[model samples]
Target: MRNLVRYCLILSVFIMFSCGENTDKKSGENTVEEVQTETEIQKSEKNVILFFGNSLTAGMGLETSEAFPALIQNRLDSLNYNYEVINAGLSGETTASGKNRINWVLNQDVDVFVLELGANDGLRGIPLEETRKNLQDIINSVKEKNPDTKIVLAGMQIPPNMGEAYTTEFKNIFPELAEKNNIALIPFLLEGVAGDPKLNQQDGIHPTAEGYEIVADNVWSVLGDVVEKE
Candidate 1:
Protein backbone atom coordinates (compact mmCIF):
# COMPACT_ATOMS: atom_id res chain seq x y z
CA MET A 1 0.00 0.00 0.00
CA ARG A 2 2.88 2.39 0.82
CA ASN A 3 4.54 1.67 -2.57
CA LEU A 4 1.21 2.09 -4.39
CA VAL A 5 0.54 5.44 -2.70
CA ARG A 6 4.09 6.65 -3.56
CA TYR A 7 3.57 5.65 -7.24
CA CYS A 8 0.23 7.53 -7.38
CA LEU A 9 1.79 10.71 -5.94
CA ILE A 10 4.62 10.63 -8.58
CA LEU A 11 2.07 10.11 -11.38
CA SER A 12 0.01 13.15 -10.17
CA VAL A 13 3.18 15.34 -10.09
CA PHE A 14 4.14 14.23 -13.62
CA ILE A 15 0.67 15.11 -14.98
CA MET A 16 0.74 18.54 -13.28
CA PHE A 17 4.23 19.23 -14.70
CA SER A 18 3.10 18.23 -18.22
CA CYS A 19 0.04 20.51 -18.02
CA GLY A 20 2.17 23.46 -16.81
CA GLU A 21 4.68 23.01 -19.66
CA ASN A 22 1.91 22.95 -22.27
CA THR A 23 0.32 26.09 -20.77
CA ASP A 24 3.67 27.92 -20.83
CA LYS A 25 4.21 27.00 -24.51
CA LYS A 26 0.73 28.27 -25.40
CA SER A 27 1.36 31.52 -23.49
CA GLY A 28 4.65 32.07 -25.36
CA GLU A 29 2.88 31.54 -28.68
CA ASN A 30 0.22 34.12 -27.75
CA THR A 31 2.90 36.67 -26.80
CA VAL A 32 4.66 36.14 -30.14
CA GLU A 33 1.40 36.59 -32.09
CA GLU A 34 0.60 39.77 -30.17
CA VAL A 35 4.05 41.18 -30.96
CA GLN A 36 3.62 40.38 -34.67
CA THR A 37 0.23 42.11 -34.74
CA GLU A 38 1.65 45.23 -33.11
CA THR A 39 4.49 45.33 -35.65
CA GLU A 40 2.05 45.06 -38.58
CA ILE A 41 -0.07 47.86 -37.14
CA GLN A 42 2.97 50.07 -36.77
CA LYS A 43 3.96 49.43 -40.42
CA SER A 44 0.45 50.24 -41.68
CA GLU A 45 0.35 53.45 -39.67
CA LYS A 46 3.37 55.05 -41.37
CA ASN A 47 2.35 57.99 -43.60
CA VAL A 48 3.65 58.24 -47.21
CA ILE A 49 5.46 61.11 -48.90
CA LEU A 50 5.40 60.61 -52.67
CA PHE A 51 8.00 62.46 -54.78
CA PHE A 52 6.58 62.38 -58.29
CA GLY A 53 8.82 63.73 -61.01
CA ASN A 54 11.27 62.88 -63.81
CA SER A 55 15.01 62.13 -63.95
CA LEU A 56 15.93 64.46 -61.11
CA THR A 57 13.68 62.69 -58.66
CA ALA A 58 14.72 59.32 -60.11
CA GLY A 59 18.39 60.15 -59.33
CA MET A 60 19.43 59.42 -62.90
CA GLY A 61 23.17 58.85 -63.47
CA LEU A 62 23.74 58.27 -59.73
CA GLU A 63 23.05 55.70 -57.07
CA THR A 64 19.45 55.67 -55.84
CA SER A 65 20.74 56.52 -52.35
CA GLU A 66 22.27 59.71 -53.73
CA ALA A 67 18.93 61.01 -55.03
CA PHE A 68 17.17 63.93 -53.34
CA PRO A 69 14.15 61.82 -52.44
CA ALA A 70 16.34 59.32 -50.59
CA LEU A 71 18.11 62.20 -48.89
CA ILE A 72 14.72 63.50 -47.83
CA GLN A 73 13.95 60.04 -46.43
CA ASN A 74 17.18 60.13 -44.42
CA ARG A 75 16.19 63.50 -43.00
CA LEU A 76 12.70 62.25 -42.13
CA ASP A 77 14.14 59.20 -40.39
CA SER A 78 16.72 61.26 -38.50
CA LEU A 79 14.02 63.64 -37.30
CA ASN A 80 11.99 60.69 -36.01
CA TYR A 81 9.27 61.44 -38.51
CA ASN A 82 7.23 58.33 -39.29
CA TYR A 83 6.95 58.89 -43.05
CA GLU A 84 7.80 56.72 -46.03
CA VAL A 85 9.36 58.54 -49.01
CA ILE A 86 8.29 56.98 -52.32
CA ASN A 87 10.33 58.12 -55.32
CA ALA A 88 7.83 57.90 -58.15
CA GLY A 89 10.30 59.49 -60.52
CA LEU A 90 10.73 58.23 -64.07
CA SER A 91 13.39 59.29 -66.51
CA GLY A 92 12.07 61.38 -69.44
CA GLU A 93 8.65 61.57 -67.80
CA THR A 94 6.75 64.63 -69.03
CA THR A 95 3.73 66.27 -67.43
CA ALA A 96 1.30 64.40 -69.68
CA SER A 97 2.92 61.07 -68.94
CA GLY A 98 2.93 61.86 -65.25
CA LYS A 99 -0.78 62.65 -65.41
CA ASN A 100 -1.46 59.31 -67.09
CA ARG A 101 0.56 57.52 -64.37
CA ILE A 102 -0.84 59.42 -61.39
CA ASN A 103 -3.79 57.04 -60.96
CA TRP A 104 -1.55 54.02 -60.61
CA VAL A 105 0.64 55.87 -58.12
CA LEU A 106 -2.33 56.93 -56.00
CA ASN A 107 -3.31 53.33 -55.33
CA GLN A 108 -1.50 53.70 -52.01
CA ASP A 109 -2.31 56.30 -49.37
CA VAL A 110 -0.27 59.51 -49.67
CA ASP A 111 0.02 62.13 -46.95
CA VAL A 112 2.24 64.56 -48.90
CA PHE A 113 2.25 64.72 -52.72
CA VAL A 114 5.25 66.57 -54.24
CA LEU A 115 4.50 67.25 -57.89
CA GLU A 116 7.83 67.50 -59.73
CA LEU A 117 6.90 67.27 -63.39
CA GLY A 118 6.89 70.05 -66.05
CA ALA A 119 10.69 70.19 -66.09
CA ASN A 120 10.84 67.54 -68.78
CA ASP A 121 7.88 69.09 -70.53
CA GLY A 122 9.52 72.49 -70.44
CA LEU A 123 12.79 71.05 -71.70
CA ARG A 124 11.02 69.24 -74.51
CA GLY A 125 9.15 72.46 -75.33
CA ILE A 126 5.76 70.82 -75.03
CA PRO A 127 2.89 73.26 -75.38
CA LEU A 128 2.56 75.36 -72.22
CA GLU A 129 -1.24 74.94 -72.23
CA GLU A 130 -0.93 71.16 -72.43
CA THR A 131 1.65 71.07 -69.66
CA ARG A 132 -0.51 73.29 -67.47
CA LYS A 133 -3.63 71.29 -68.15
CA ASN A 134 -1.94 67.93 -67.52
CA LEU A 135 -0.51 69.22 -64.26
CA GLN A 136 -3.91 70.54 -63.20
CA ASP A 137 -5.48 67.22 -64.05
CA ILE A 138 -2.85 65.38 -62.02
CA ILE A 139 -3.52 67.65 -59.06
CA ASN A 140 -7.24 67.14 -59.49
CA SER A 141 -6.79 63.37 -59.55
CA VAL A 142 -4.74 63.46 -56.34
CA LYS A 143 -7.33 65.69 -54.68
CA GLU A 144 -10.15 63.45 -55.83
CA LYS A 145 -8.42 60.37 -54.42
CA ASN A 146 -7.72 62.07 -51.07
CA PRO A 147 -8.77 65.66 -50.63
CA ASP A 148 -6.66 65.95 -47.51
CA THR A 149 -3.46 64.99 -49.31
CA LYS A 150 -1.07 67.97 -49.16
CA ILE A 151 0.18 68.93 -52.65
CA VAL A 152 3.61 70.57 -52.94
CA LEU A 153 4.25 71.80 -56.47
CA ALA A 154 7.91 71.88 -57.52
CA GLY A 155 8.48 74.93 -59.73
CA MET A 156 10.80 74.37 -62.70
CA GLN A 157 12.67 76.58 -65.16
CA ILE A 158 14.34 75.90 -68.50
CA PRO A 159 17.08 77.86 -70.24
CA PRO A 160 16.16 80.46 -72.88
CA ASN A 161 16.77 77.78 -75.49
CA MET A 162 13.01 77.25 -75.41
CA GLY A 163 12.56 81.02 -76.13
CA GLU A 164 11.94 83.63 -73.43
CA ALA A 165 8.13 83.56 -73.62
CA TYR A 166 7.90 79.78 -73.48
CA THR A 167 10.40 79.57 -70.62
CA THR A 168 8.49 82.18 -68.63
CA GLU A 169 5.18 80.45 -69.24
CA PHE A 170 6.52 77.05 -68.26
CA LYS A 171 7.92 78.43 -65.02
CA ASN A 172 4.67 80.22 -64.32
CA ILE A 173 2.64 77.02 -64.51
CA PHE A 174 3.78 75.80 -61.09
CA PRO A 175 3.12 78.93 -58.97
CA GLU A 176 -0.15 79.56 -60.78
CA LEU A 177 -1.35 76.05 -60.04
CA ALA A 178 -0.22 76.32 -56.44
CA GLU A 179 -2.19 79.53 -55.98
CA LYS A 180 -5.22 78.20 -57.81
CA ASN A 181 -5.22 74.92 -55.91
CA ASN A 182 -4.23 76.57 -52.63
CA ILE A 183 -1.33 74.16 -52.11
CA ALA A 184 2.33 74.48 -51.12
CA LEU A 185 5.01 75.41 -53.68
CA ILE A 186 8.77 75.09 -53.97
CA PRO A 187 9.75 78.29 -55.80
CA PHE A 188 12.57 76.58 -57.70
CA LEU A 189 13.37 72.88 -57.50
CA LEU A 190 16.97 73.62 -58.55
CA GLU A 191 17.47 76.92 -56.79
CA GLY A 192 21.21 77.05 -56.18
CA VAL A 193 22.21 74.12 -58.37
CA ALA A 194 20.62 75.03 -61.70
CA GLY A 195 23.38 76.60 -63.76
CA ASP A 196 26.34 75.52 -61.67
CA PRO A 197 28.50 73.22 -63.77
CA LYS A 198 29.82 71.50 -60.66
CA LEU A 199 26.34 70.64 -59.45
CA ASN A 200 25.13 69.14 -62.69
CA GLN A 201 26.13 65.93 -64.44
CA GLN A 202 27.76 65.81 -67.91
CA ASP A 203 24.28 66.25 -69.41
CA GLY A 204 24.02 69.58 -67.59
CA ILE A 205 20.40 68.78 -66.71
CA HIS A 206 20.43 66.28 -63.88
CA PRO A 207 22.18 67.14 -60.63
CA THR A 208 25.18 65.30 -59.30
CA ALA A 209 25.02 63.33 -56.03
CA GLU A 210 26.40 66.24 -53.98
CA GLY A 211 24.07 68.60 -55.80
CA TYR A 212 21.12 66.43 -54.82
CA GLU A 213 21.88 67.21 -51.15
CA ILE A 214 21.05 70.87 -51.88
CA VAL A 215 18.02 69.76 -53.91
CA ALA A 216 16.90 67.79 -50.90
CA ASP A 217 17.23 70.95 -48.83
CA ASN A 218 15.10 72.85 -51.33
CA VAL A 219 12.37 70.20 -51.02
CA TRP A 220 12.60 70.02 -47.23
CA SER A 221 12.23 73.79 -46.83
CA VAL A 222 8.61 73.59 -48.03
CA LEU A 223 7.92 69.96 -47.13
CA GLY A 224 8.85 70.40 -43.47
CA ASP A 225 5.97 72.80 -42.98
CA VAL A 226 3.44 70.47 -44.62
CA VAL A 227 4.44 67.18 -42.94
CA GLU A 228 3.67 67.21 -39.23
CA LYS A 229 4.24 64.17 -37.07
CA GLU A 230 0.85 62.88 -36.10
Candidate 2:
Protein backbone atom coordinates (compact mmCIF):
# COMPACT_ATOMS: atom_id res chain seq x y z
CA MET A 1 0.00 0.00 0.00
CA ARG A 2 2.81 2.44 0.78
CA ASN A 3 4.54 1.68 -2.53
CA LEU A 4 1.28 2.20 -4.52
CA VAL A 5 0.66 5.55 -2.78
CA ARG A 6 4.19 6.75 -3.57
CA TYR A 7 3.85 5.76 -7.26
CA CYS A 8 0.50 7.59 -7.58
CA LEU A 9 1.97 10.77 -5.93
CA ILE A 10 4.93 10.72 -8.27
CA LEU A 11 2.68 10.34 -11.35
CA SER A 12 0.41 13.19 -10.20
CA VAL A 13 3.41 15.52 -9.68
CA PHE A 14 4.79 14.66 -13.13
CA ILE A 15 1.44 15.30 -14.80
CA MET A 16 1.05 18.70 -13.08
CA PHE A 17 4.51 19.82 -14.14
CA SER A 18 3.92 18.73 -17.75
CA CYS A 19 0.62 20.64 -17.91
CA GLY A 20 2.23 23.77 -16.44
CA GLU A 21 4.99 23.73 -19.09
CA ASN A 22 2.49 23.40 -21.95
CA THR A 23 0.46 26.35 -20.60
CA ASP A 24 3.58 28.51 -20.38
CA LYS A 25 4.57 27.60 -23.92
CA LYS A 26 1.09 28.51 -25.23
CA SER A 27 1.23 31.88 -23.40
CA GLY A 28 4.58 32.70 -24.99
CA GLU A 29 3.30 31.81 -28.48
CA ASN A 30 0.26 34.01 -27.97
CA THR A 31 2.46 36.95 -26.96
CA VAL A 32 4.61 36.57 -30.08
CA GLU A 33 1.59 36.35 -32.37
CA GLU A 34 0.11 39.47 -30.80
CA VAL A 35 3.30 41.41 -31.37
CA GLN A 36 3.47 40.37 -35.04
CA THR A 37 -0.14 41.38 -35.61
CA GLU A 38 0.45 44.85 -34.11
CA THR A 39 3.51 45.39 -36.29
CA GLU A 40 1.56 44.55 -39.46
CA ILE A 41 -1.18 46.95 -38.50
CA GLN A 42 1.35 49.77 -38.03
CA LYS A 43 2.90 49.06 -41.42
CA SER A 44 -0.44 49.15 -43.25
CA GLU A 45 -1.12 52.67 -41.98
CA LYS A 46 1.97 54.17 -43.63
CA ASN A 47 1.59 57.13 -46.03
CA VAL A 48 2.63 57.26 -49.70
CA ILE A 49 3.89 60.47 -51.26
CA LEU A 50 4.46 61.26 -54.95
CA PHE A 51 6.88 63.89 -56.20
CA PHE A 52 5.99 65.15 -59.70
CA GLY A 53 8.22 67.70 -61.38
CA ASN A 54 11.11 68.28 -63.79
CA SER A 55 14.93 68.03 -63.60
CA LEU A 56 15.03 69.69 -60.22
CA THR A 57 12.92 66.92 -58.78
CA ALA A 58 15.06 64.45 -60.70
CA GLY A 59 18.22 65.78 -58.98
CA MET A 60 19.78 66.49 -62.38
CA GLY A 61 23.21 67.57 -61.16
CA LEU A 62 23.37 65.19 -58.21
CA GLU A 63 23.23 61.47 -57.81
CA THR A 64 19.80 59.89 -58.23
CA SER A 65 19.85 58.84 -54.56
CA GLU A 66 20.68 62.36 -53.37
CA ALA A 67 17.61 64.07 -54.80
CA PHE A 68 15.50 66.07 -52.42
CA PRO A 69 12.67 63.55 -52.65
CA ALA A 70 15.12 60.76 -51.86
CA LEU A 71 16.41 62.77 -48.94
CA ILE A 72 12.87 63.16 -47.71
CA GLN A 73 12.44 59.40 -47.97
CA ASN A 74 15.63 58.84 -45.98
CA ARG A 75 14.51 61.28 -43.32
CA LEU A 76 11.13 59.60 -43.01
CA ASP A 77 12.71 56.16 -42.80
CA SER A 78 15.18 57.23 -40.12
CA LEU A 79 12.38 58.77 -38.08
CA ASN A 80 10.50 55.46 -38.23
CA TYR A 81 7.62 56.85 -40.22
CA ASN A 82 6.07 54.24 -42.45
CA TYR A 83 6.09 56.07 -45.80
CA GLU A 84 6.87 55.47 -49.49
CA VAL A 85 7.99 58.26 -51.83
CA ILE A 86 7.48 57.89 -55.56
CA ASN A 87 9.80 60.00 -57.72
CA ALA A 88 8.08 60.97 -60.99
CA GLY A 89 10.61 63.63 -61.91
CA LEU A 90 11.54 63.75 -65.57
CA SER A 91 14.47 65.72 -66.98
CA GLY A 92 13.53 68.94 -68.89
CA GLU A 93 9.85 68.41 -68.22
CA THR A 94 7.54 71.39 -68.27
CA THR A 95 4.04 71.92 -66.94
CA ALA A 96 2.75 70.65 -70.25
CA SER A 97 4.73 67.47 -69.89
CA GLY A 98 3.64 67.11 -66.31
CA LYS A 99 0.02 67.43 -67.38
CA ASN A 100 0.57 64.73 -69.96
CA ARG A 101 1.88 62.35 -67.31
CA ILE A 102 -0.46 63.29 -64.48
CA ASN A 103 -3.11 60.69 -65.24
CA TRP A 104 -0.71 57.79 -65.24
CA VAL A 105 1.05 59.00 -62.13
CA LEU A 106 -2.29 59.20 -60.37
CA ASN A 107 -2.78 55.48 -61.07
CA GLN A 108 -0.50 54.73 -58.13
CA ASP A 109 -1.71 54.79 -54.51
CA VAL A 110 -0.76 58.36 -53.72
CA ASP A 111 -1.66 59.93 -50.38
CA VAL A 112 0.14 63.23 -50.88
CA PHE A 113 1.32 64.97 -54.08
CA VAL A 114 4.27 67.36 -54.25
CA LEU A 115 3.68 69.47 -57.35
CA GLU A 116 6.95 70.99 -58.64
CA LEU A 117 6.38 71.59 -62.34
CA GLY A 118 6.47 74.95 -64.27
CA ALA A 119 10.18 75.61 -63.72
CA ASN A 120 11.01 74.37 -67.18
CA ASP A 121 8.14 76.40 -68.54
CA GLY A 122 9.57 79.45 -66.83
CA LEU A 123 13.00 78.66 -68.23
CA ARG A 124 11.63 78.21 -71.73
CA GLY A 125 9.57 81.41 -71.46
CA ILE A 126 6.37 79.49 -72.06
CA PRO A 127 3.24 81.56 -71.67
CA LEU A 128 2.43 82.12 -68.01
CA GLU A 129 -1.31 81.62 -68.60
CA GLU A 130 -0.59 78.29 -70.24
CA THR A 131 1.57 77.25 -67.32
CA ARG A 132 -1.17 78.24 -64.91
CA LYS A 133 -3.80 76.34 -66.84
CA ASN A 134 -1.71 73.19 -67.09
CA LEU A 135 -0.96 73.27 -63.39
CA GLN A 136 -4.62 73.87 -62.54
CA ASP A 137 -5.62 70.92 -64.66
CA ILE A 138 -3.00 68.70 -63.07
CA ILE A 139 -4.19 69.62 -59.60
CA ASN A 140 -7.79 69.07 -60.63
CA SER A 141 -7.06 65.71 -62.18
CA VAL A 142 -5.13 64.55 -59.12
CA LYS A 143 -7.98 65.62 -56.88
CA GLU A 144 -10.45 63.85 -59.12
CA LYS A 145 -8.55 60.63 -58.67
CA ASN A 146 -7.71 61.00 -55.00
CA PRO A 147 -9.88 63.62 -53.42
CA ASP A 148 -8.38 63.12 -50.00
CA THR A 149 -4.78 63.33 -51.14
CA LYS A 150 -3.13 66.45 -49.76
CA ILE A 151 -1.20 68.60 -52.25
CA VAL A 152 1.97 70.62 -51.67
CA LEU A 153 2.70 73.05 -54.50
CA ALA A 154 6.43 73.77 -54.82
CA GLY A 155 6.73 77.27 -56.32
CA MET A 156 9.56 78.65 -58.43
CA GLN A 157 10.68 82.19 -59.04
CA ILE A 158 11.73 83.37 -62.49
CA PRO A 159 15.21 84.83 -62.83
CA PRO A 160 15.18 88.63 -62.40
CA ASN A 161 16.50 88.89 -65.94
CA MET A 162 13.14 87.60 -67.14
CA GLY A 163 11.81 91.20 -66.71
CA GLU A 164 10.07 92.41 -63.55
CA ALA A 165 6.51 92.20 -64.85
CA TYR A 166 7.01 88.72 -66.30
CA THR A 167 8.83 87.57 -63.20
CA THR A 168 6.05 88.88 -60.96
CA GLU A 169 3.48 87.06 -63.03
CA PHE A 170 5.46 83.82 -62.82
CA LYS A 171 6.05 84.20 -59.09
CA ASN A 172 2.39 84.90 -58.44
CA ILE A 173 1.21 81.77 -60.24
CA PHE A 174 2.00 79.32 -57.42
CA PRO A 175 0.40 81.11 -54.48
CA GLU A 176 -2.64 81.89 -56.57
CA LEU A 177 -3.07 78.30 -57.59
CA ALA A 178 -2.48 77.02 -54.06
CA GLU A 179 -4.98 79.46 -52.68
CA LYS A 180 -7.56 78.62 -55.27
CA ASN A 181 -7.08 74.88 -54.83
CA ASN A 182 -6.86 75.15 -51.05
CA ILE A 183 -3.59 73.23 -50.94
CA ALA A 184 -0.34 73.78 -49.10
CA LEU A 185 2.33 75.84 -50.88
CA ILE A 186 6.06 76.48 -50.66
CA PRO A 187 6.71 79.96 -52.06
CA PHE A 188 10.09 79.23 -53.57
CA LEU A 189 11.53 75.80 -54.27
CA LEU A 190 15.08 77.14 -54.70
CA GLU A 191 14.96 79.35 -51.58
CA GLY A 192 18.51 79.94 -50.29
CA VAL A 193 20.32 78.07 -53.07
CA ALA A 194 18.97 79.69 -56.25
CA GLY A 195 21.58 82.43 -56.63
CA ASP A 196 24.28 81.01 -54.36
CA PRO A 197 27.27 79.92 -56.44
CA LYS A 198 28.54 77.65 -53.69
CA LEU A 199 25.21 75.84 -53.61
CA ASN A 200 24.65 75.51 -57.34
CA GLN A 201 26.43 73.27 -59.80
CA GLN A 202 28.55 74.47 -62.75
CA ASP A 203 25.43 75.23 -64.83
CA GLY A 204 24.19 77.59 -62.11
CA ILE A 205 20.72 76.18 -62.75
CA HIS A 206 20.74 72.88 -60.90
CA PRO A 207 21.75 72.36 -57.27
CA THR A 208 24.77 70.47 -56.01
CA ALA A 209 24.49 67.78 -53.32
CA GLU A 210 24.79 70.36 -50.54
CA GLY A 211 22.33 72.67 -52.31
CA TYR A 212 19.71 69.93 -52.42
CA GLU A 213 19.63 70.04 -48.64
CA ILE A 214 18.39 73.61 -48.73
CA VAL A 215 15.73 72.62 -51.25
CA ALA A 216 14.76 69.68 -49.06
CA ASP A 217 14.45 72.01 -46.11
CA ASN A 218 12.23 74.34 -48.13
CA VAL A 219 9.86 71.51 -49.01
CA TRP A 220 10.08 69.98 -45.55
CA SER A 221 8.96 73.15 -43.84
CA VAL A 222 5.59 72.80 -45.57
CA LEU A 223 5.56 69.00 -45.77
CA GLY A 224 6.10 68.50 -42.03
CA ASP A 225 2.70 69.98 -41.27
CA VAL A 226 0.87 67.77 -43.74
CA VAL A 227 2.69 64.70 -42.46
CA GLU A 228 1.71 65.49 -38.90
CA LYS A 229 -1.94 65.49 -39.88
CA GLU A 230 -1.53 62.20 -41.71
List, residue by residue over 1-230, the lDDT tens digit for candidate 1.
99999999999999999999999999999999999999999988999999999998999999999999999999999999999899999998998889889999999999999999988787777889999999999999999999989899999889999888888888888899999999999999999999999999999988999899999999999999999733
**Looking at candidate 2, what is the lDDT of residue 188?**
96
Clashes of each: 0, 0
Error in Å for residue 145 of model 1: 0.5
Best by lDDT: 1
Q: What is the lDDT of residue 210 in candidate 1?
A: 84
Candidate 2 residue-wise lDDT, 1-230, digit = tens = 99999999999999999999999999999999999999988866778999999999999977889899999998888887778888899998999988988998888778999999998888788989999999999999999998999999999997877788889999999999999999999989999999899999999999999999989999999998998888
| Candidate 1 ranges beyond 4 A from true positions | 1-37
TM-score of 2: 0.81
The residue ranges of model 2 lying beyond 4 angstroms of the native Cα positions read 1-45
Whole-model lDDT, model 2: 0.92
